[model samples]
Target: MTPPDQPPPLEPAELSAYFALIEVSSLLRHTIEQQLREAGDLSYVQFQLLATLGDAADGSRRMTELADGVVYSRSGLTYQVGLLEQAGLVARAPSAEDDRGVTVTVTEAGRDVLARVFPGHIEVLRELFLEPLSGADVRTLDRVLGVVRDHMRAVPPRSARSRRKGAARRRPAVDDA
Candidate 1:
């Protein structure tokens, strides 16, 4: 750990503030997760994955890209894709330009599922969160979160050594297979 006197290291309070922000976000996220899980039979991570694909131009995203953006490994995502495939919610197809890279596309059944649940989900958010916020509050949140998102994306992914070190400390038994 870097010493407090070092100019490069952020202060303890700064680190605490960062943690508090994460906690606050997690608390809010839990509410959405619970609602989605109970009401729609979807995990928060699954919902994110589905929504990301559903929003794509062709409703298809490459496996590696999807893995990076969502809370799943390439293999774990492949498993989820297989499950979704069995459920008739999505289909996998080889990329035309590169046979080595496959893409998962939402099926018509997936669209039907999304259509059934999306409106209700939006309503839940409106009731639980959005409706209470003033217009100014909404705009301010949009601006601030946009800046934070941009800044966070600016940081490059960690090197393998750093990633392994952090993952080890967290004790996350990630099933890469």
Candidate 2:
């Protein structure tokens, strides 16, 4: 019997959708970051951290809570928060019960910065992303994106098996042992 025909090795041209998605995302983030920097001197992540905390009740969110709300990991949040705190864009305070934990709060200056830039920000959203699509198109796009995200998350991610011998729970915690 003859061997079955082999598939070609994956290339950038073969990953058109995936490559386009990543490139577009990078460009969008860079553009937004530039606009933010020009208007209020905030990086994309910093602006998002502030916005996330600002949306939380009492204008504060615990470190873990904040991390889960956004894409950053706990350590990533830590690094970003340190920078924002230094710039006085965000304030870090001890959580009520967890002395080991911190709560992030957006400052008045932060809010002022947001207010100054938000109008232009909305305009950018309108002109670049939103206004180009009809309302129905926007809704459909959101639904499709949601479906794609759900599918991606539902699929188990591949990783090398760890040495720890236990049934994995929700999140993998580092073993200090």
Candidate 3:
């Protein structure tokens, strides 16, 4: 019998799968980071922010929404958005729907940066991440990860805590680390 507070250990195969996922993720991100830096002079988080906003139909999202979408801390996202705002890439404005909400919009400059960066981003993904995977493997991986992502998101991690009613518009304390 196990202690009530003690969780079961991962089986060997589970451990292997977890480590492989971590290592592959690290390798892919390293290459993607280099590409984004060189092509758009943007960090991975910045590119994610810009791309997310660029894809938004209204070309804008509330700061809390961006934090959820990118799985980033509110403070970190704020700093990145500040940098983009300073670069004339994105603009922050009062949300029309909620007076207390701040919406972030990708400026034309941000769109231009995404356009410049996307080709190399796709290439890096293809070369370092996707090239070795078969179509069946890709499909299985996508389906599995989608399920995993959904399961994780359902729990409302720290970044997703803004989804709570009164918390939605409240400024989060810095937890960037």
Candidate 4:
């Protein structure tokens, strides 16, 4: 028998998986944040911005692109980038391609910081995240999460008017016959 007014609930296995994901995400972030702060005197967002710029082909990205890549608000990213600029870890300049846009690039100093922080960061990741998973488990997790990410990205958030508008803006144009 079921209660008429109540909505269907997740099965136990589904609930367990959901909660585990949430808990693991929170715990991992906390650990990583502490490690970053202690090792590099860097906040997670600052580290993320530096890392993202470091990985770019030109070691630079447009402010809008960086904002989307880091899941940060444009204004917040501007403030963070300002701090990085002040620290001499990054530089900002008017975009040559778009007069209205700004490009952010990591400095030699930023790379130095990354080099200093990387060893410890890797150790933390290996200890907290990788050690518990077998090779097969790692592979499976990667594949599963990739699918989930693609699905989620394809579907706009509830606040958005439609997936088409949001997803289209995020992805490059493609022609289909």
Judged by TM-score, which candidate is best? 3
User: What 10-residue stretch in candidate 3 is worst by lDDT?
Assistant: 168-177
lDDT of candidate 2 over 58-156, digit per residue (tens): 888888776655655667778989998888878888899788888889998878888887887787777767877899999998998899877644522
TM-score for candidate 2, please give it.
0.74
> What TM-scores do the predictions have?
0.73, 0.74, 0.88, 0.83
Q: Is candidate 1 or candidate 3 better by TM-score?
A: 3
lDDT, each prediction = 0.73, 0.74, 0.88, 0.84
Off by over 4 Å in 3: 157-177
Candidate achieving higher lDDT, 2 or 3: 3
For 39-129, candidate 1 gives per-residue lDDT tens digits of 6577676777788889999899987678766636667788888877888888988987678988889888887777766877787678766
Order the candidates by lDDT, highest first: 3, 4, 2, 1
> Compared with the true structure, what per-residue lDDT tens digits does model 4 show for residues 1-177?
568998788899989999999999888889999988888889999999999999999999999888767767667888999999999999999999999999999999999999988899999889999999999999999999999878755733222324465454443211100
Clashing residue pairs in candidate 2, if any?
Answer: none
In candidate 4, stretches whose alpha carbon ends up further than 4 angstroms from where it belongs are 1-7, 155-177
Which lDDT tens digits does candidate 3 get at residues 79-166? 9999999999999999999998999999999999999999999999898888999999999999999998787566555644555577
Better of 3 and 4 by lDDT: 3
